[model samples]
Target: MAEPTERDPLIQKPTVFTDADSASRGEPATKQRLGPLEISASNRRGILAGIWLGTFLGVLTLVPTMMPSISSEFQKFHLASWLGTAYLLATCTFTPLYGRLSNVMGRRGANHTAIAFTAIGTVMCGLSRNMESLIAARFIAGIGGGGLFTTATIIVSDMYTLRNRGLVHGVASCFNGLGMGLGGPFGGLITDLLGWRAAFLLQIPLFVFALILIQYNIRYVTPGKSKGTMEMLKRIDYLGSLTLLVALGSPLFFLSARYNESLPWSEARVITPLILAIVFILGFLGVELFLAKEPVLAPGMLQQKVPVLVGASNFLVGACNFSVTYFYPMWFQVVMLQSASTAGMHLMPNSVSMSIGSLFAGWMMHSTGRYKRINLIFGIFPFIGTTLISRLREDSGPIHSWLSIIPLGFGNAVALHTMLIALLAHLPESHMAVGTGFAQLFRGIGQVLGVAISSAIFQSRLDAELRKRFHVPDAENLIRQIRRNSNYIRELPSEQQAYARDSYALALKTVYIFAACLTISAYLVRLPIPDQDLDKAHARQRAQAEARRNSTAEVATTNAVASTSTGSGLPTPEYPARSPTETETEPEEPAA
Candidate 1:
């Protein structure tokens, strides 16, 4: 057999098999496939990661569809809003923790832990008797769901080199889009047929299946393993974690409480938490940068230009993506007078286009090994889509709404997945998990912010419109009724119904316009991203790592040889050391 070289496809790359080597050995390449699929090992891992990503996102997306059903059953419309808020809050809070934990405990252990939390939370949600209980359960599920998303991305980074990660991320994103797209329709269907509880209960088995697949097939690379439980516990940055929790939790509470309760921003419920959140954010930065030996978010990572810019862009993209995700269904339900199931079906176009966009971006990156230009080009779609969406009226046809969503969905998927690949490409392997986690954290924060801002805009506009249009003494009561139950608007007289629909349509337009501006800002920030060949970068990284290992081995071998010679009573040969000038002169003489 020939000696292996770095350029030899079969030698350096462990994730896939090359046909050239297979032909020489009279065997088939890519023989060790994933289940029944005829693909490489790396591709299989990508598929698994996608399944995990999609499942987590699917379960999270179920809450929006379930809101109406929950309100109808529990008679607490206020608490219904918390279903999504609670989940998002928990997700944002625990994402960083999961990232740090994955670094310490290994990806498999952290992943399994997340799956268990999700399953338990799902069961709790299914069995809950009240809205509060369900909210609490959703919070638990959010923790797990967030972990699944962060770790799944990290696992893809671990399994594939930079060159291949674009496609892998794209594949995973497609599943994410699929899960999100299906979640609404599926939740509504299950809710209508069996009940809303069935929606949560049905997910338990699927979680189990995902858990089993990951346990058996997914490979993990664990970093910072400790010898004992106590040591591991000691390694955790407790203060940093607490500060991060407060920093994230307080702001989320402030926004959610203000919007969900219709309180002024100056109210105690809003201002107190907002102030505390600010304080904790400062504390978090201080502890991470100056105090903690092992920071939850490393200060060094914050300093890196690429990671910082990419993370910021991730935040903006998240805001745009999730704003559309949460609001469009409401538009379909309220403005278009569609049922929850029908609204979900209307969202199918966005989901399908998003999947197509993700796959397209991935293929382009894999083939061209370029993303900056692609990102710049695709980044325009969101602005265009949102601008078009902003023009929607109450009487707009399905074709108009659906067509507008396609660009937003496609633009979001392409930008999001591609930026993730770009992020992983720029960071070192050791920091990949943390970087991915922070990206998710920012995205979650964006989702929470998007919902809060949009909700506030929608509710305030609706209230003003109702007051202006209805000059009766019971107008306030009617507005309250409509706010509490969307069905109330449908029950109103034709003129009132049109007025209410127009109000919602106008509010949505503002939200879409805001999202468009946010998307454009993301495009501007993303311009500074460094475009490098992912394959070449990974190859260099591998070479450096191998060189280090070889140097260490050589040192050990030399030391062992010296020890053996001494033990055997052999004379150690010594040579006179030459000066630097002598060495230089000798080389010059040889050349002469």
Candidate 2:
């Protein structure tokens, strides 16, 4: 066979071998230190393990396997969904601040803060005596959970170059997939054995381990000259952050009230929050665009084509992927009459497929330094998976149930990995933290929004179906019980049980259809993102930095020569100079 032609210059570049080749020879991943520690590449394993453990903790909370049991205990099934929503709402709201916080507090301090919050909140969740208190505790946990993953991403970026980031990010994603895949089963098993409260309590020891790992393995480095604590505090955009909370929180409140609780649209409690949400959204934009000195969400980043598209894609995919995570298991338990543990186990295939997809995308980008084709191709996976899912019936076999969700998980993982690479490729080094924050913020919003919207749709459809099927005077009370509690279906008569299962199946079908639409929209939105070569972009950044340094050095030399020759008749020594061609102005890099 003929030798394959090399179309890209990066494929032939020898320097591309630096990290991988050194690692193969058992050298440090990079000469750079992580925090104050000068650990070798082998020690990076511990850092990754710690980071993934924290991620596993965060994702473990997302599954809520004992939600049905918790709701039944509280006798407030309608409020049960809030346990998850509250966590997600807090996660999305606080996420943007972590990016900036890492700069002021240093990565170590920020990471430590996140772990502390998660630990405190998890404990409170276990101790809660009421539904309201439990939701509040979850909100606190979410505040900490949001930072763990984002800080981990920032730490990895510091360690790896753009060329190597793909592989590293991919591996990181495998941990994410591991957490996501295992979270369901783990939570289900824990719930079955010790009850839901134990699930929260059991995560505490792991959180402490993660905290110790971060302390020993990761250190915070100030970006520039050290500033006073007051000065650093000043840099945080208090106004923008607060405004963002209102902007995001209000709409979620409105959704939960209007749909989840079945409140009328014209009710003051519902309409007022919706209006406030809209108003704050506008005000938040104003603050970011013109008011804050260092805006929480930079206006300049969103002005560009790549970040905008990537953010939107993240949002859509988050909606679809998270919706599946939260609701798919309910299908097994409610419709197919499976136990919580078995339902959780059924999620394993989707999670495994997601890990495979994430690894594949990461390796591809790392080896090839290209992501455009991968981005475009993976968008279709979720759409196909969700479409198949929407058609699921109570009679659907195990093979059909297991196989249907794989594409959504696999495809969603690939799209997320590739889109992240694509966004990072176009951003300047200085903006990486905030730029990444922006993407994560959108995704967090989508996760909450997806679940909230799906919950609303599910509850509404189930209520209508039940009311239509049963005309007895007690029908209203029974429908209310069914809508609020998943476990309630099991207590009904055999005839009623069949009808309730069918109703749940139908409601889930509608929810999946909505999710399918989101996946297809995400697929279409990803089409216009420009495919920048990772190596080439890094090469340009290096070239630009070199040019600036040389220009500064030339200016210094010219000044020194003039000063030395001011009065003395001694001739000035020749200094090397660049030709006109070498001094040509380079094109400005596209803004983040």
Candidate 3:
């Protein structure tokens, strides 16, 4: 009988051996450095699959555990924010660490470490006794969660021809969104109905499910080489890692508490963390240039054309997204006078739109694999949408009001996912983590400012407008007071509420305008991406590297055969290759 074809799954590429070949060779899954790329087709599949799976698994694990009904019984909003932030910083922090670790342990071990992180963190979060304990537990979860988005993306480069990546990205993101939507609502309900601790328990089943899938579908990962371990270690910038941890994690930590406490903005509570971040960042940069054997998150990586320019564009997109996500609900709550539930319902359109946008990008990417142009085109849509959305007046009808946001949402989904996918296309296989990691890092940094900038725009305008319309003696004071809490707003008369809402609307308009501007800046970067069929291009590079290896081996075989197989001093074969013009480009210091 004829064998079944490889087309069983819509996105799965055809494979000749199902990585069964690795099992037969009895190759120890130990690390082997082969130029820049690692070898282990099956392991990469599991790792990649797990990364995508973990993104959903790791994130949603928080859902069923939310304690909306009993904040005292579970955790408060501040504590919950830690869960999400910890995950974000953890993912960012681990990217370089994983890249280096991939070199040391091979992809299989590095990938599995991520799973272990998720399992342990989930348990700790579920069992936490206080807010601080939960925060610590979630930080651990972040280490695992970091692997979810970063490494899965790296595997796309490691495992497939460039032609196939768009399809894979689609499948990966679709699952990610599905997990988020399901994780957020269902988890919330579980916490609301059962208990907050129940949310963390949700991950228990997901971890088991992932294990089953990992066993069934994957068995191996790309392994690094054995040479230069000591030399590489010496170059390792240990201080750089510390600096990065502080530079990023510290600032966000401060921002989380920025609004919670009253401050001079110059006090040590704020100044201390900020100072630490600056010092470390400078120290990290210095070590990267002069001291380390191998710098983590190299400056060259971020400064290059693809990584920096593209990353900057994404930062803008991130800024817009971060702003919109924070303020939209606020508009509904304060202006529309809706409860949290109703505000969420208002947000459903954009959320659902993002999900659909992700699916659409996936399908289009898979069918055509010519996604670069579409990436650019769709990016503009959100920019325009946001621009239009920002123009809505105080009296704008609901139908006309939100239509602009739909386009921006579509634009947003495509811009971020597409740009992220685009990073791998331009970068070498070696620097995939660096490329994706720093882009996301910039985005994270941008998000912090996005909120601040958007808030400042909204609140400042609101203050001026309130003063103009109502002649309030302390409009600026009112804004500062309200930001601390809403209790003060409730004291105002009905006419005051109406006037404040208009001022709030004006503030929101300016913020949305800022969002649109950020989105537009992304377009300039996309125009210069030098779109090659990256999956195919990268595959060509690897295939060429393999050919060189085989040629070297063949010469060794010929010499041995010609020498009558008697020489005790037989040497490893030299690599064979085409002439310089014909040879494939080995990625230089800066891969992008």
Candidate 4:
């Protein structure tokens, strides 16, 4: 926040470059009490923001859950997941855009904007009659709900002090899990008794509650006015945002729809979108380097040692994140032979485990002020478990699958939230939002691509296997045959059923194998980050920052003395008060 003056000293401020797990750090007592806006942040509003964010996510999850219901209502089973995919894409795509917007608009304002978007979208979804109308409404809601999750992290980081950031992040994390944890039951009950449409309507009252809390309990603070719209626009890196969105969303959009379409992956429908996304990303990176003064995703942010290592690792975990979130339900439905609601019920533990992991991570970081040790131990658990799950046969029931998923869920909890703490700890303060936004965006991109790539592998392998043995052109036909006559294939079908089931099994296994590889990759990425020296550089910068602050104060004192020189005929000199950034860093022992 400080600007260098003409005679300012050359002492450098300490710039921490934590990339992933840094958000878990806790804030100090004093700083947590106030902020740049001069509003007391360690108040009820902070908790309100977390609740609103989690509720919106909960509401969004309902869209996914209700999609199948809506599909059955409209007799459009094909469009079921699109209800979710629409929101997921929007949330993942626009989070960075909201981050940049919030940087200009103020954190409190971003919260309001997110709530508005989510509320409106949820209401619209409830009212929609057709697939087209439903998808459009979900898309709008997705935009609003998308930024809520990412910005919530920023709000916690901005509002709370560094030392206490972990606690806030952990507490904040509980809300999302709570929403999902509750949503499965709540949505099911709502849909079962009231109808699927009623599930979307429930979010409206929650939004009203959140809005009332914000207007009264939350302080409304504006951003600095001096930057101006044009300067903000110049820094937005629109090309980069577009590039990132396309690169991420393209794969998802294609894969989800491709199988349903005749041409599928072979058509320009898929190929064209894929190529355009890649081209745009390459172009955006080029523009980011040469043109933008303050690019949205700065080259420095990417090239920084901590970020690069953490980011690569994040990509791996991101794959698991998508797989776990998207396919795990399907696994429960198919493997566990449970209804959709029942599958979600079974998934309750994963959400609980994630919440627990986040809290534990925050507490550990707060107490010990170190992340690598716990992170390393927990991060590997899921990788090992998920790998084991991939080896299980199709007939493997709940017990066999749980052997992998229990640890899969547990290990993921430790790895992701821990990485978040490490990241927040390492990123420079000036670029905190950008760093967080990019982390979220690329993480989303990794997820989209992971699902698409993994899905492609599954579909292709399954298609080949089915066609070779059953003489079916694709897996779809095989599934249709099974659905049409349960025992028809079983009757003639020793070889035929074996081929179809084997292909299906292979496809699922392939997905798991890819996920396991990603976990291993993430594990390796985290390993390098720990041994890599970061603390020493931060220490030097902290010392320099202190010297600069002292020097500035002394200069102001000398100016005051000069002003009192009565013999000199000159007027009293006016010295400017030092800005917050120009002032001394907080007196905390560690930078956090």
The numbered model that scores best in TM-score is 2
Candidate 4 per-residue lDDT over residues 1-592, each given as its tens digit: 2454545433322222111111112111122223333656456565556445545463434533443456666766444555666665666667666667665545555667887888898899889989889888877887777577776777666555555667667776667666655566566567767898888886677687776665554443221212333445465666766665676666665665565232456777878776776777787777667765555455776767777776677667777766655555555544434555765664566667767877887777677667788877788887777777787775767666654566666676667666776776676454567777767666665665665666556555655555566645675665544422322334444666565556556667777888888887888877866531234434543466467557655664565445444354333323222222211122111111
Ten residues in sequence with the least summed lDDT for candidate 4: 583-592
Reference-based lDDT, each prediction: 0.69, 0.77, 0.59, 0.60
- Name the TM-score of candidate 2: 0.86
lDDT of 3 by residue, 1-592 (tens): 1332444222222111112122223222233223212445655566566567766775453321242222334425323344445555665566556555544434445566777797888899778887778768877877777565555666565566665666667677666555544554565456546666766776687777676555454433342222233443454457776777678766665554444333447777777777777887788778777776566656776566777777787778767876776566556656665443444444556656777787787667667665677877787887877877777765668886656567777777777776776676666554665566667666655654676456556555665676677656776566555443332445678887777777777777788888878888877767777666654766665675567546644664465454432344332222121111111111122322
Consecutive 10-residue window with the lowest summed lDDT within model 2: 580-589
Better of 1 and 4 by TM-score: 1
lDDT string for model 2 (24-114, tens) is 2323223332331234676677677787788778776334567777888888888877788888888887887788777666676778888
Better by lDDT, candidate 3 or 2:
2
Each model's TM-score, in the order given? 0.83, 0.86, 0.73, 0.76
The true-versus-predicted C-alpha distance at residue 589 of model 3, in Å, is 9.8
lDDT of 1 by residue, 1-592 (tens): 3443344332121122222223223232344322112336665665475346535543447767767678767776644656776777777767766666664455566788788887888899999999889989988988787888777776666566687778877877777778788888887778778988988888777777777777765542222211233344465678977787788778667766776566887789989999998899999889878887666665676778887888788888877877777777788887888778887776677778888998999999999987888888887888888888888877678678678888888888888877887887776554566677767777887776766666666666666766677776788777777677776777899988887777777777777878888889988888888888878767776675456446644654565455435643443323111111100000100000
Q: Which residue pairs collide, candidate 2?
A: 301-592
lDDT of 3: 0.59
Compare the candidates by lDDT and give the number of the best one: 2
lDDT of 1: 0.69
